[model samples]
Target: MTAQALPPVVDAETWQRRLDELRAREKQATRQLDAVAARRRRMPMVEMPGYTLEGEEGPVELADVFGDKSQLIVYHHMWFPGEKWQCPGCTGFTSQFTRLGFLDGYDARFVVVTQGPIDEALTYKRRVGNRMTWYSTANSPFGAAVGAPAGGGFAVNVFLRDGRKVYRTWHTDGRGTEQLGHTFGLIDVLPYGRQEQWQDSPEGWPQSPTYSRWAGSEDIAARYGPDGGTA
Candidate 1:
């Protein structure tokens, strides 16, 4: 489908009034999000067992991932055993989180874990120029415990360390994982707003087959690679 013409021009006063109305809603949404976060902080945590995963240097325990920090966030990347490539959706989500040195400042660490072979994961990491730590749980039950079993979907898991013990504080999947990507946040502000068929845009606005059209495009893979090159 093609893009529709721009919205009709309106006077500055009308524009300002419309923006002010939306700004109120935005503020309300922000407060609602803050409330959710507050509740998340209070959620009870489960103790995590001594699980081992394969890293670049070899097998490593789950607690080791936290480094000297007390917090860890792991992206359960969906990479099934024997698959030639990792999940594109996971890659897209991770592409937004490569520069994670800032998390160190907060005494936190982030890592990507998959069920695929460690060598394969490393190859993809190098090809995509990922800077965050990565590990493979192919020989462990880490993926299943985190709701990302073999051939399963993506998830983000948060953990807290108390001395030598580790506890799972929170986990989220599906739309909840969207917080990791800025693209959707950026798209929501556009005039056409993602241009997805499901969006409630005005009549004649461009619309396409949601994520399928964008994910199936070769350009997306190319764009995710180094220097805008193909992966």
Candidate 2:
């Protein structure tokens, strides 16, 4: 299909009427999402053991991750030991939350957890210019419990701290994690809609392979030194 064969242009009155119809559905969807979130808040919680993780300050316990806060949000990053680079999808997802300082005002702490070596994790952190806290879950049960395991996948885990004990309050994976990045949400409203072959775009709309071209740029690759150091 060609660009000239795209959807026909309509008059202003027709366009507004169609947009209004879509807006009504959008509002309904928003309310439905809010109702689902309310139900999520009422779900049962699971006790999380004192799992150890390597932090910038050395080995730290899961409770320590909260850092005087009552709630903790962990991004289960997919970086395995011995991999030359971290997962690009995980990196992009994390890059969206680097400046989430507002969570502090609501008594919440967020951190990225990975199974990679501490040194390599730090190097990737610098290369991506991340300002958020990152910890290595190497040799820890945190990854498996959170659904990321030792291979490659992304997940978000929420926890609540009571006194010295920590409990997993909620968790989400798959498309549920899409809410973390504005890029996906924003593109979702566009006419082309992510330009991915899987989307239900119009006949003539453009589409490409999804997430198959995320290799780090040349400048970013240069940040890693000969010894795999981000100096």
Candidate 3:
């Protein structure tokens, strides 16, 4: 990298002036996000089927997953059967959400629902030190109905409960779920930004292939295993 292309030294006033301009843009983006969320709040929801899922304790109904909470968020985690581990992207993404007790105050519950068997799913949960509660849709078509069929990619789904009935309000996959994981947002604020080739980073800033950092990352899971990401 050429020294000239690096982040240039600037007087404090010049830096603050540039920062003020960026802050204006940031605030505008925040307002736009609020608008999107407002629209989301008004979106129509579809009533869901009453399906039974396998929780760690045993079989559980869809509404029961909410545990008296009025709202539900499910991460349709991708799984590969007979393997010692599951999807690393799903693993790393879900791992970032631990001790999410604050959601209780909002009358909401968030949990993992996968097509993998309950036994193996829980095993992988402990293996990765993921702390989020997990459940299995191996027997029912729950995962398939909710956009994460067996052998498919990952997705995030939201639902609302009115008494015994459950309704799905929103669902998203691919990059749409990025907002839930703060790791990317935090990394993005850095000068280099995710450091991935796809990013529009400044010239001469560090860059790498997407997901290159996660390659051969079992040791990371092991490091978190004791304090635990845990069943």
Candidate 4:
């Protein structure tokens, strides 16, 4: 069957009412989310098994990486085959890590773990100029053992440790970006914004069909290898 004809455009006053309704619905959703976060915070404690992660100073235990911090957030970064490239979405989250002072105040640490060669990971780190730690799990079984998805995507995991071992409390998609979306932060101000490809945004929103690496006049192909861009 052919598609139905579109509805006529609403007047300005009607549009304003619709926007107010949208905002109200969003507020209710935010309250629900906050409640869920409170529940997650109460997750039972567990021990983190000791494993050496390849850090800037070579293999180091999980507890050692967190230093004196009480909590650890790990980003399981995807490393696609052969191109020596990292997930563009993962890189986007890493960009915000340096600016996060909440970690210090809350006794938490954040790090990105990838299955790429150390040199490639280090190069990506330098290119992005991020202060957060980046390490390799490509050769290590730490990622898979802790339930890394086989589909090769980004996973944000929150861990708590009791001495030498760490326990996972939460693992989520989209890098916990939903927490910052409503307040109109830097990500929302960007040309292609963050809610990823699944947002329920209005028509004519400036969502790119690909990552922002090629934003503006930059040539990403020469720098990020053949599999770069939306391919």
Candidate 5:
């Protein structure tokens, strides 16, 4: 698909008008989502049951991984045993994970779990140059049991703590949909916006697919993956 082009001459007044319109819409959407979230907050919870993950030091329980936090956000990072490509959306979400502690003000701990064999996962993280808490569930039931699709990588999940018991709260699996939340912090001030070509906005704006900044991912997804341009 071809990109929509902007007119050669957009006056200052027109530009300001467009910016104001977008900001107004953004505020309205945020309120609507906040209302919807209040409803979702009442959804039933599922006991997580004891699960373990292979951390840098060794096996670590799911509950212990939260450090001192009461809430946990886990990204089911996509990295198969032999596959060269990980999920583009997951990568994008992970790129946002660097700001984990910033979300700590809300009592949350964010971690990325990969399906690659334990050592392979550690090695890959170094190769990709990510310092985030990368772990492997190769020996546990966490990945498959928690809605991470068959081959892996489809969701970012949040779990809550109640005394000694932990429960799953919410999860999401889509591009650009992540901007709906105000909890997680941003790693850097993005000067070019998202730079992704498929954002749900007017023409000529830039939005980089969340994961396009990763090594070799640009060729993996030419324009936010094959379906990015669509709604």
Candidate 6:
């Protein structure tokens, strides 16, 4: 049988020296993130048109999704018109966020917006163990207006509301939204660092196809349903 690979062992001094060098680079990356956040804070936003959306409680307007909060963070979940399950990647990524109510501390609220019909979206939401309420944009132009049109993929869109007026402050899709999911960050810190085929790793390191870790997330999602789990 083939033996498992591992990082090379080194003396205490050597390990400490190497770790210190990596820590310096890690600190620099942290500062760069801080700089980027400063720029995002100053970014210009576009005014969004008022539109109606279908909520679990029936029809509601753009500002209504924010509840009483001035800030709204919407996860645009990719939906298939007649599929039993929506995008597995989106399902797994979003279901991990079981505790978003804490956003209230920042005067913000989080919710899921999907392009499918209300009934279908809600069913999928429960089936995938989603905690956030799902709203349907099937009849609203808002989804497309925000760059998350049906069948186009998923997105993370941030909006701000002043009275009844709404503005989009930021939008991220593709790899740009990766940081929002905790799984990747946690995995990246492990010795294997995702062990994905696309990553740059030393020879003899374990590796597999990109995003092949969905099964692990499926276990997480399964625990979110009504049967047996706490947020």
Model 1 over residues 105-156: C-alpha lDDT tens digits? Answer: 8999989998888998887776665666899999999889878898888899
Candidate 2, 175-194: lDDT as tens digits: 89887678788778776667
Assess each prediction's global lDDT (C-alpha) against the native. 0.82, 0.79, 0.87, 0.65, 0.67, 0.85
The candidate, 4 or 6, that scores higher on lDDT is 6
Off by over 4 Å in 3: 1-5, 215-217, 227-231
Task: Report the lDDT tens digits of candidate 4 across residue range 132-204.
Answer: 6888776677777665643467777778876776777777766365463233365665544564556555555
Summing lDDT over every window of 10 consecutive residues in candidate 5, give the lowest-scoring window. Answer: 182-191
RMSD of each: 2.4, 3.2, 2.5, 6.5, 7.6, 2.8
Report the poorest 10 consecutive residues by lDDT, candidate 1.
212-221
Ranking by TM-score: 3, 6, 1, 2, 4, 5
Which has the greatest lDDT? 3
Tell me the deviation in Å of residue 213 in model 1.
4.7
Candidate 1, position 20, lDDT: 100
Better-scoring candidate (lDDT), 1 or 2:
1
Write down the worst ten-residue block by lDDT for model 3.
Answer: 222-231
lDDT of 4: 0.65
- Per-residue lDDT for 223 in model 6? 67
TM-score of 3: 0.93
Task: Compare candidates 3 and 5 on TM-score and give the better one.
Answer: 3
Best by TM-score: 3
Candidate 4 displacement at residue 11 in angstroms? 9.6
Q: Point out where model 5 deviates above 4 Å.
A: 1-4, 8-23, 83-89, 180-215, 218-231
lDDT of 5 by residue, 127-211 (tens): 4445579878888888888877547545677899877688999877654346534322243233334455554544665556754
Which pairs clash in model 1? none
